[model samples]
Target: MSVIRTAILGYGRSGSTLHAGPIEKNKSFHVTAVCDVDATARQKAVARFGCRPYDDYRRMLKEEPLDLVVIVTRSDQHCQMTCDCLAGGVNVLVTKPWAVNAGEAQRMVSTAKSSGKLLLPWLPARWGSDLQRLRQLVVEEQAIGTVFLVRRVEGSFATRNDWQTERRYGGGYLLNWGPHIVDPPIQLLGSPVKSVYGRLKQTINPGDVEDLFMGILTLANGILVQVEYTVSTESPPTWFLQGTRGTIVVHGTQLKMNARTPAQPSDPTQYSTMQAVPDKMLEEKLAGSLYGDEHQIYKEIAAALCGETRYPVTPASALELSRVLDAIRTSSNENRVVMM
Candidate 1:
């Protein structure tokens, strides 16, 4: 069998639970190494994968001839790690906050372009059936005329209190969770942001970064998106969309999408909603979520990079997210609308 040698650069919780297991299961990709800064974590990663361990990413890329390097480390290290791997002649698939700001995203994008290496964001959220259906619905000229509003809420009691509390670490409610929630809206809207107004409140985190954040985005195409999120919430989770036709609301991981999009008579629009439910809900790309059959994500990504199919997590999409995030932070700090 032809398998791409893949290295996972972090073996933390998200890395272990979400990424490694799934990717290893793909059969098309071999888990060549698992990396982390802590010696104990490295030992465990090595034990788990029966692969070598490296304290430094630079060392890993230098010693191992890899087909792909998946970055699951902190925000500060993401860009440098990505650049290093690309410069080392390896393809990269890294976690979000692709950079600290839009400028960083641009540089990374430029590097990927020049090196001819694939750089895609780790937004598996886009891999779901519901979002793809929504994207398809928008493209097919559905009742959701023009996609006027995309309102999303990324709720978690664990996130804000955990790694998201510190701004210096690129920690915050938005930075931690906003990427997944905001991806669909931006993709559906397909409009470059024109301006943004933001509101930030430090609800739980004792650090400089925000805890609960909300932003109003005005796209160049005149689409408006509202991103509402918090790190502390026990309420029923919700992620939703609205257009001229109707709405689609997915409550949680049950593939439970309650949709009301622009009306479609005799077309069984609800079937589209029902069809949008993902057969699986994977928390990370390298691991299986709920059950088996978890190889599609990397298979699709590798295929897309090799010009066989389309990979949903494009660098352009990552750039768009960063741009919106930059505008939001600027608007919140300057106390005025900022143009993107």
Candidate 2:
């Protein structure tokens, strides 16, 4: 098998640590070059990876022979950079928010389709251990019968004066932490969102954009998923799964579950307002690490590049996420539920 030569754009934030670190750990990928405008970051990249560094991304694209380009720049730059890379005959693995809106995401997707290049979104949450376990229980084993509601809550009491708090730079909790928070429930629900009702506020951040948001997604299967990402003082359970027979809650690394036995009606005419029937309710406590295999996504990317298999995260799915995000914004702005 031949190693896939790769280049990275942006080194300050996720470019080096998130993109380069994983690529370097995977044997199928080779970091051929790195592009960053920061002189110090470029020097650090050379020292760490021993790869040539360029200040200009286009110059690096022109000079280097690369199979893949990982774009980890500001959210606003994702669309254009991805299109440029696809046009240059290199597959793109861009981090979310892949685009600020669904229209931009469509352009990126269309460009990749026209160029015959792979466009993958960096959605690591799909491979998270908690979600994988949930899938096994809810979908395969039917441990939790008929999932109806799923909730993901993540946030802290804090304020940042960084670029992330500003709208012009494509910075907000909605774009920053929203993708990771939203992907798992969507995958588990296995349905396209039918409508979105969202509320965004600028609570503590100094930016013009909202620092926190509460987004309610009603899926096609009628499963309701609520996502609350805030910078406020309240910290809730990380995850909540409610089904017909059971409920699951995750607090830190611990998962607690309670499954009630199915109650059978003995008589056709007897309708009791309340009756306690004990059929031995199942209770479980799962305690341990709640992290997925870190390099699984990179391994899959290598396989996809080798034509051995298709990348699991499809362009259409990523675009759907973008569309959901767009609807959330619309709902928040207009103060009404937006239909898909």
Candidate 3:
């Protein structure tokens, strides 16, 4: 398709702001229709994008001749809606935490395969410049030597009383920000996870679910990754990486690094006299902004649809992330480490 005809299945915050905005900005895509349960939202979509709007997704699927459907609905509805779109002979791009669990994610993947349609998870963070720089420094350049520990902390003193705080709706920190936070460290580690230990706590959020969560992942190479999020306190560093020969701390748009090359003393008794040393101290700017460029993902998607290139986030990789999510939730609920 020269210009992919796209329809948005949800016209809420994520649908309008995150999905529709970038898609409309891309030259390879055109917003043809929108579906939302709310009549007001449907009207808003029609006015904003000058497109046909429907109150039901099934009706939109049946009526619109769309080449792609962007499913931006609630977490629990992602799997079925994706399957419906794929079965309707349209490619699908669903929002993060694509499904409630691994089983649902697998079902969506299977349906897409059976229908011979493209399935993509909305993981735009994979294209972030900060992550690109991290990969270049940590993996490609080995600037930090052998990475032994990685920590990602994201949170602030705040509270949410929305539907997101409700567990019945697949609402919690694990499914909320977890996909974005969890995938990066794992991707940087470049190794299969051996085990996961997780913990969940309800601090300030007015819901039955947790607002604070932590996950400790042990990778196959013995690298340890720790991710902690909360709504009750001030946030620490966005990223901290500790390696055998150096340490990196992400301070806003720059990386502050301290590194040294160790030279063993000729005498065994000189161990205590070793100088407190970091031979090098450096500050490097990130490759680009940590956020923005939602359109890049849409461009890639359009190219993938046209058979020009491969999509970075594949169905198989998404399925693996779903399984990792399952393990984290199970570990938290059972209060024990879950081995992968």
User: How displaced is residue 334 in candidate 2, in Å?
Assistant: 0.6
Per-prediction backbone clash count:
14, 0, 0
lDDT of 1 by residue, 1-340 (tens): 2567888887887678777877867766777887788888888877877888888888888899788888988887788889889988899988766787878888899899999888878776666555555566566746444567777666666533555577777787677666766666776667777888988887655767777888988888887888877665574444566655455554554323233343334665446533232222223122233112336676776686566776766788788788888878888889999987
Query: What RMSD does each model have against the real structure?
Result: 7.5, 2.2, 1.5
Candidate 1: list runs displaced more than 4 Å.
136-141, 144-146, 157-161, 231-237, 247-250, 253-294, 305-307
lDDT of model number 2:
0.85
The TM-score between candidate 3 and the true structure equals 0.96
Clashes of 3: 0
The candidate maximizing TM-score is 3
- lDDT by residue for model 3 (310-329), tens: 99898988888888888988
Best by lDDT: 3
**Looking at model 2, how many pairs of residues clash?**
0
Model 1: lDDT of residue 27: 66
Give all candidates' CA lDDT scores. 0.72, 0.85, 0.86
